[model samples]
Target: MRLKILGFTTLMALLAACGGGNGGTNPPPASNTLSGTVRLGNKASSAQIASSGRLLTSDQEEFVPGEVIVRFKPSLSVQSVSSLSVGGVSLQRVRALGLESTGLYRASTDTAGTLRLVQGLRARGDVLWAQPNFIQRALKTPNDEFYPYQWHYPAINLPQAWDIEDGTSSPVTVAVVDTGVLVQHPDFAGKLLPGYDFITDPRQSNDGDGRDANADDPGDEPGGDSSYHGSHVAGTIAAATNNGTGTAGISWGAKIVPVRVLGVGGGTLADIADGMLWAAGVSVAGIPANPNPAQILNMSLGGKGRCADSPAYQDVINQLLAKGIIVVVAAGNSNEDAANFRPASCSGVITVGATEFQNARARYSNFGPRIDLMAPGGDVQADLNNDNFADGVLSEHRNDAKNDYDYVFYNGTSMAAPHVAGVIALMKSKKPALTGAEALDILRRTAHPLDGTACTGQGPDSHPGSDCGAGLIDAFAALQALDGGGGTNPNPDFTLSLSPNSLVIPPGSSANTTLTVTRSGGFSDSLSLSLKGAPNGVTGSLNPSGNSATLTLNVAASVKPGSYALTLEAAGGGKTKTASLSLAVGTSAAKPTLEGAYVIACFYLGNDCDQIKSRIIQVKGQTSGPYSFGDLAAGDYLLFGWKDLDGDKDVSAGDYLGAYVENGQIALVRPSKSGLNFALEEVQGTGMLLDQVQHALRSLRSR
Candidate 1:
């Protein structure tokens, strides 16, 4: 909501490790060597590689009996070592290698010809990288937990769907691209494989070591305390199952790979981009590959921009998508059009919007044609228990200033994005064969479209049927769709055009428009058309005959002139098509425009004329003014007026400060402006009333 200016220097330092190291005055490539005793599966004799290059056996651990890892010196290649005497017998030829988990002679090589060989072993079946597990500990729910009622459910229903398919057997890896995960949490213990930290503040690490993950520059302070944005997200994805503790994850059997990108304020685009590659198991020249790779990448943070089409960001995203990784991003929180933001706006990534538990769009959730699906982002302020005020939602938060094992409530699209990510993991677990795009298509096709204001129609209206991109997402429907048929067309062909593409009509005015629908196939009788994004004070209706439909609307005089989109849907005969119409409307002729210097005096009046009391005055307005009245506490208000001697309406430049009027009455007779002028105080009793009235007038002028 608020933009914090960040120093570029800090960003550059965080991004330094992202770039592959190049040859120059920098130190030569380090040797890949390990000097330690190797023992067999049983505690038999131990084999050691001494500094003299002789392999000797002792009672400690044995290397020759089983697979053992051996590091070769510089300039030596695995291909040259065709035959080597292990236990006095020449073994098979050794070749350059990839990776082995943790046995003897597991071979992996660096670009400098240094080889790591696992002695007496060969590559076999695929290695399953486990998700980060969470350690569940019970604490009295904190009083500060926001919106506790919404989080009342012990374990959501979707994870149960995963259990039906035995999904936890081979846990899927979900990368939490936020603050680092609490590896020590009871729910996350042993589940967290090795991961990297790109914060560059030199204070954050996978382990609590002073050294960075890459042994490069010191990283930033892992700002874990701000919010458990990552931990909560991880918990939702894979917290560990049947531990008999708190809530269960969508894929309780899966693991989490904590990729710390965001920090104190937030992370940069570069850090996020690099984190994506690392999580997907993409190899970089200098840094060691992720000890654990992810099948699904969850990004719950986003900024405002059309990032989907940007080449700089898309290139990296495309690389991951190509690797069969489902990238889920949060639609922003601005409650504006989501087509204007990055990551979410990108085509390949699954962009998720938020809705309340009541199945309506969250008041603060952003929407647009770009939104692929919606999930429950608790409306903390909603009167879930019939209360008048919003209590907060219960979630994981930064426990303390140090950002450790603390958990609290946090409500945002950040909280909602993980729900969908975890769902995707369950989907993937059920149907491991589904590709990223196929899984996304299934989720969208199966989601139960939310009805009412939550849906953004191509036209203006807050009602259910007038919104956009279907309705609220239905997890049950999504799983069903996955089971029925996995994939569908990512891009479909359909065209919708509207007349009077843009217009500005006064309040209480009406306009007529037509939506033309064209499809690749012939016309059909059964088609459904809906409108979204209607400006305030405007309403629309559609009259469908055949292939064409007429949309009629009247704009209220109070309607603000702005751009709006009209989404038209044509579904029939087992297939559906979507299109949008853009519209604009002007402000009302008699709309109140506040001007000049003023002070507000708020009041509450009872039904009877006899009861009136002063109330708090809060301001909300555009940036052109000094304050915003929108943030004001509730109550009616009056404003005090000041004269504009120069007639400028504003007290600025060379204007003279005129006398303040307590009421409509003032020494100046008949002020020239409409809704201007004050009556003289002939009765003392009316002075208080005049003061309130004058305050209201001043408040209007200030706006």
Candidate 2:
């Protein structure tokens, strides 16, 4: 995705960082041709590209097809693992970094097979999880640059990281899926991979061609010199460090795959999504497959939008996730909620936001729950270093007007994203199996928290995890975490689900499920429903009104003969609930279906056992104790009592903190014959997190 240039201020002084000079006198263009609303819309579109390389289209925001996730019971058996291969089908395993036995799979590219595989897998007693994956995406937010002098690297402790993992020992490549790069730039000398240009619309291509092998910067400015944005991003990722060059990159030994999907007038949803797929070595219909696939994709560009609206883009990202490619996106420079931006808010991405020289959230950097980590994007307005020049991310820039390359300071979440991508490259080099989800877990655990007003507040303001993300990216700590981390999971509500679960529809026929909601914790708040896995010619619609809705699917007569698996995800009440059902084309007895939503919740107790927090779960017919708990929060408890939910410090509705407490053990549960008695009055919890949990529990008690 491309963002029109935002105006920059002048104040060039000494380029101490790069041992260079000149900050320039010219100001950023007085005005931008691309409006904010339209540009944001474009970012959302880029993630889920339509086949047509157009900017606006009705079918751009759909979810990925032919995908599903299944959680198996704990201490898994070989028989269960081997069963992934259905009798007459092939199940491609994506990632397995969730819970102990959770697996993601591309059951079938065809709708029919997808359904059968899911149905068959769920039929197995060992599987424990299934659901839809949601996804969202933005650019460097802007500021002054001095070539080769990047302070952001030090902010994240890159020097220490380099000593531990310079990425030289392994062949690591990161895809810069943006405006393309300048091949001749010395910073990219030995690091450039032969990349592809996915911009099909010649008008946007600006090179008088479409879908060519050339992946060079043709420029994205309307009537000015090229911004060299991709080149800048590449420089940050793997610029030649200690090579006596213009600037040093984060992962010095990593390679760069400069894929171009944006041009003069920005990018389209389809072109960008397709470019990402192609970069990951996934085959696109008309384009040639990428021969040198990358381990990471750094998207320093994006737009504002909800993940739900861009299901198509979400689908592409889920595929990337399955392939274990770490997708890093800029949190955007909107200065608002990153959760509203595409890709950043989308599931499974490492969303990076920018911090200034003072280690505070950048004024323009978007902040919210969606941010995964923070990095130095720089500030051109404040010269805290007394360098006269604004402290911006310094990298390679081409001044076509002067016919020479220039190194300058620039600010934006865009700059921040590359910094993260570079770090991920280093991590991927060490742990070959590092998925985007795992990368985040490590980043969060090791990040240096931005507290003490530097970037700590609540909502619309700065707040760790929720706003500024896990804090400033720490290369050193992250590397340390790589040595220590493993598990990753769902991060959500009135729990909702659909069932009988699987229905078979014949050609030219239809099926329906009545949707229902399960309320808890006074989740009387409004609830809504949406769908993600239906294929073409299959019309899936839902009623927007009323507390209860119906999801009706109509299959056209010309539809292919096959089975389809559908998933329902309920996110609310501080929890994430998901379920799946199968759809097949067969002459099976039909029944009017009620899309039912239900839940069962529990927590593990005992200091020696792994304390699982509230998922508020349960299958319809599961037993109240071990059966409903499944492999979840399973462990030994010395006493019967209530789960503390939060640590003794706070009460928890979901998973943030605490556990079940029994007789003041802080967390435990004592089952009562009269249904079940939840004794919240005596449980002790302290802290803001607990306060919220207490309120939620109170609501549930009254209900």
Candidate 3:
């Protein structure tokens, strides 16, 4: 599943999706007795959110309405920017940041106008790329919960591993990039860092605001079956253990960063990317830098399609990897090729598959070469262990059904991924500077052979999954591989990576990225760096202060025009590491005048014009070219666009349905003339058609 555009289809059942089963057991009595809202499927109501406030069929075309994300060529000047208008519709630039602050603008238009707006923008020469903000779903399988019954930890020898490196000191942060969490749960009290809510849509956030500092779980179910998904995933990684609490986590002292990405309707690809990047301390526009940067990111969410389909995700993931942040993802639960799902299929991530208490691949865990290792992700359908409940991994969650926060059991690659993330926490705690690549290599090298049935293949894929990673993870062995991780003496090693791997620089200009060093084993040595394969007349300089340095490159105006691959090498204490950088030297061609460009309401609204419903505004006016709508009553009115994407307007398919809008809805009134032709009040945003419109378009697209 490669994504050419940085987008995703609406997320489906996450790896931790709840099957139809009464979740086993309920939360034990809490010490506080006052837990707030949060969940993964254990007797759970898996309400994966999509946040699109529309009613469509199972196969709905959902995206933020009245908005389009456009990446303009860097050469285009801000002065050359203009509102693109087509068929009486116009798009106004709402906001821009990231992508090196290259004019990556989110444009806004009126409701029912996304289709026309996207077409207009795509037709322009200056626009490098354009796409609607697509939503992504959480990963986790639904299954019908107690901590004593948690066999997952011992299954991976975590009990012994704890004695070696329990993370009592030098605790690192593991970012849970999933649904929001319940900050008040006793098990998580003092265990959470100040995380952020990256959900940008109010409806999806269910918190009634855009991105903010609050990272608490508001519940994922709009109709009441909310799952505190993020909370569950967090507990598995850092639930307060031996505190007379419910369950024991892999890393008891590790801090959890709750970067909420999934909400009412799961999460958007845009929000997910931002959340992951922010977790690693990358700057996201309109959001503060993360004070508690994570050493690892636990994404128990994903969607179908190739990883390449979403360049945004790939770019962000690369950034995280370059920062030495370990990323762990669920291998999906479709019982098929792990390569078929994203994030898991993406490179540089530790993709984990599920194994039951018996040490065999769980019935639903995806398999294939993409899997880095297997971990205990129980089978919730049957009580193979005779525990009197479902055979699942135990963890704490916000149990709304029990009207309290308590323990529950769930099973999926979602469960498996966190176990690895927790192990990473322990590793990083032992070696504060362990790089992501080093962590993966250690895990794979220390892994044990599969103990599950077949020992070779699982899932419904075509061939035997002999390539399902090295084998089951052995936590104790992994810690031992760290060599004195719990001891004062350790092997000394260091890693280097360059950020913004690719840079586009205009001739005679300069660009800067970052070079970071991660030193392990308490090694303290002076560092020196140099670059290879540089073009003539191009010079680079930086001062290494501590573990980071700013690498600035100046290209002589005489340099040739082309892309150059450069290698950055770092050396310290008789150890060396090499990283790559991409440099492009050229200026984009000038843009031609826009044809039939109709600038809409570009006045007072500014960027906020795209903040809400700028799409398909409602108003009735005279049949004139310029519609100030004189003599029109101030009463609210409905709009009907002449768009039937499928060429057949059918109400059942939600074709051209009047947008469900109110409260000073922006009005798009063409001349009251028989033919519709009027300048819009220029909205500044981007989005796909309403889900209703998308529902019909989906059919047309399939054909």
On TM-score, the candidate that comes out on top is 3
lDDT tens digits, residue span 1-703, model 2: 0111111110011111111111122122222110000000111111111111111111223323455555666767323553366535676665442133555566555543343354445445565434322222327534434232567777888888888898887768899998889888766788888999877668878888988889988787757666778888888888877876688888878989988977775675556777888888887665777889988989887765665445546767888888888898888887888777787788878888888988888778888766778898887777787766777888877877777776767888889899889888888888877777677767766676666476742226554444666677788878877776421212212446563354556668876665667442123455445566877777778874455567787888777766566675555544555656566554323321111111223222211222233323111111122212222233222112122211222221111122222221222222221122222222111232233233323322211
What TM-scores do the predictions have?
Answer: 0.48, 0.52, 0.58
Against the reference, the lDDT scores of all candidates come to 0.47, 0.58, 0.63
The positional error of residue 190 in candidate 1, measured at the CA in angstroms, is: 3.5
The candidates, ranked best first by lDDT, are 3, 2, 1
Q: Between 1 and 3, whose TM-score is larger?
A: 3
Consecutive 10-residue window with the lowest summed lDDT within model 1? 130-139
Off by over 4 Å in 3: 1-67, 76-89, 102-125, 144-146, 451-463, 484-703
Clashes counted in candidate 3 amount to 66
Q: Across residues 536-601, which tens digit of lDDT does each residue of candidate 1 receive?
A: 667888887665788877776676655466566667656766655545454544332223322222
Question: Model 3 residue 416 lDDT?
Answer: 89
Relative to the true structure, candidate 2 has a C-alpha RMSD (angstroms) of 25.9
Ranking by TM-score: 3, 2, 1
Give the higher-TM-score candidate: 1 or 2.
2
| Every candidate's CA RMSD | 27.1, 25.9, 19.5
